[model samples]
Target chain A: MKDFEALKSIWHDQVALPKVSHEDVLKNLRKTRNGLASKLLIEMIGMGIAAAVLIYVWIASPFTMWTTHLAMIIFICCCIYYILAMISNYRRINYDKLLDKPECYINHLKKYKHDRYIFNTRKYKVYSIFFTAGFILYFIEISFMTSLWITVMGISFTFLWIALCYFVLMRIYIKREEAKLEEMIQNLERLHKQFEDTDQ
Target chain B: MSKEAQFKEIFQANSKKIYHLCYGYTGDDETANDLMQETFMKVWQNLDKFRNQALISTWIYRIAVNTCLSYLRVEKRQAKDELTDTIIETRGEEISEKNEQVSTLYKCIAQLEENERIIITMVLDELPYAEIAEISGISEGNLRVKIHRIKQKLTELYNRHERF
Candidate 1:
């Protein structure tokens, strides 16, 4: 069997050709700069656009009932709240700076995972409740303006959409996200333990 | 020097070693290539923030280490032992007998524990022990002991693979 010193000499003797070029990396840098729209950023922009349209409707088509005005306020608040939360979460991840040691990075990731779990479950539930209540209030005025069948259809669609989100989409999303996060955390923690084990 | 020019020089000097480190970790050329690009992408993004406290090589190694460690996000990690056959099969047609030995060495390295894989690769690359310890976040004393054990284990693995 070849000894460790011989193995080291063999390791040094092997040549490694560059698979990726400098130009390729530069091109990727430019491409990333131009196309760096994160999911959170997209969500923020969408919520901003929705809020703008809501404000336009509030101005152009005035509502008679106080409930409609209150609903508009609630809807706008939800959009703003969601956008802020996303921004906060985005900042917490610190996407630009990744210079921490492995142990520190693992801890940072664990904290982010815990925060996401709370946001996805508890904070999401509160947001959904407020959003649904806003829709119910808006529907009270909607019933008076539209025909009974139209109002019924509108409420049915809205509730059905919300129900689908709460029961199906949200459950699946949370499950997938949590599983990914858990796996990542477990892997990092195991690596961290390996480092620790060497010290002992 | 311009940042781009500096970055090009850094990439030229370090990319080969970084690829080796990544290949040592994953035992797959395609994945190692992707990871090397990812590590350089990060270095490009954060070049301005790099201080003069450490050797540029050490800093880059740290980034590469973190990049490899975080790679579990992209796909499920293949089991360590299963990696050898997959790598051999992927490169079997193109590799010379000498390169086949290199491939076998990588397969053995892949069977190591995650941190052991990183430490041994840096050792194989002939990095200074102090820098390896710093990059790995362990003391030099402990790193030496760890490297000694890893060397023994790797020798065992390589001999076993050769026997087969």
Candidate 2:
């Protein structure tokens, strides 16, 4: 090997990174998308507390026991609704693949547009169904006189928010593609310039 | 044993290689370490899906490359407001000679188009083309040509600097 190649080879061979302890790796692993589950568990606990509060308030109110029964039934249903949502979200979290190869997910986005599109599309469908169902369930639970208007407004806002988010994401993706093309062109120009100088 | 313990064992076995792959790409210890940690953090999170399709090393390499690429993107965005001359000059003062050479090589690497650099480096690391094709999602023939061109460029670069 020539001097530079020798140096480069030695550098490549001898330079090694030390292993972080198994303890640290596990600690970090525990914090991975496991945070999402931890969050859901926390949310579950919060929902339980909220449900308990609803029960306590409903029963203590001077209203009839039947109304209290209705309130308790509503609380139970809401808890069930959230539990199902949490499970669905957890299933879709990609926790297993993510822990093993977080960068693969990002690389897939940068290198494989079709895969990213497929992923985003699937996630969109899942989110839309979950949000729509939650909204419908909540709409059913509300006993106010203007509940219909509230439902209409609430549903409209959800759809509008989703549309706006999609619009912004598409714009960002388009801009990134444009920037990447521009960079490629500039790189090619520089490479050409280098060749031209060498020829001279 | 616990899933976390299993993950820890795997990471311990592979992280040094992972860090080197990261260092190969970034050529900076701090950035490489950060990328290495991020890769493992991601791996730890997704531990459940290490399907038998690919080796763990290949999966980690994929993650290392992806993290480096993302970091590059963010660095590019930051570059717009950066004092490029000052930053470039400062790099020489901070790093050792061998590291500086690696950094110089990486700077040259960045000038190549993204996939070209990726293919070439994977080849340099002596990974088989079939595995490279699998990781890059590029056909074997295309990867070969890209590697040829990248090596030609690097040789030209090395020759050019020799005259100085």
Best DockQ among the predictions, by candidate number: 1
Error of 2 at A159 (Å): 20
Q: List runs of model 2 lying over 4 Å from the truth.
A: A1-22, A31-37, A51-88, A95-200, B1-9, B26-28, B42-54, B66-97, B158-164
Alpha carbon lDDT of residue A132, candidate 1? 97
* TM score of chain A per candidate: 0.85, 0.36
lDDT by residue (tens digit), candidate 1, B1-164: 99999999999999999988998888777788788998998898788888783588988998898888888735665645544333433334555665667767877888899889999999999999999988888889998999999999999998888889
Identify the runs in model 1 with alpha carbons over 4 angstroms from their true place.
Answer: A38-45, A92-97, B73-95
The digit string of per-residue lDDT tens for model 1 on A129-161 reads 999999999999999888999999999999999
lDDT of 2 by residue, B32-88 (tens): 667788888777666676766347767767766656554543344321122122112
**Model-by-model DockQ, in order:** 0.53, 0.22
Clashing pairs in 1: none
**What's the true lDDT of residue B95 in model 2?**
54
Q: On a 0 to 100 scale, what is the lDDT of residue B162 in model 1?
A: 86
- Give model 1's TM-score versus the native structure: 0.89
Maximum-lDDT candidate:
1
* lDDT to native, each model: 0.83, 0.57
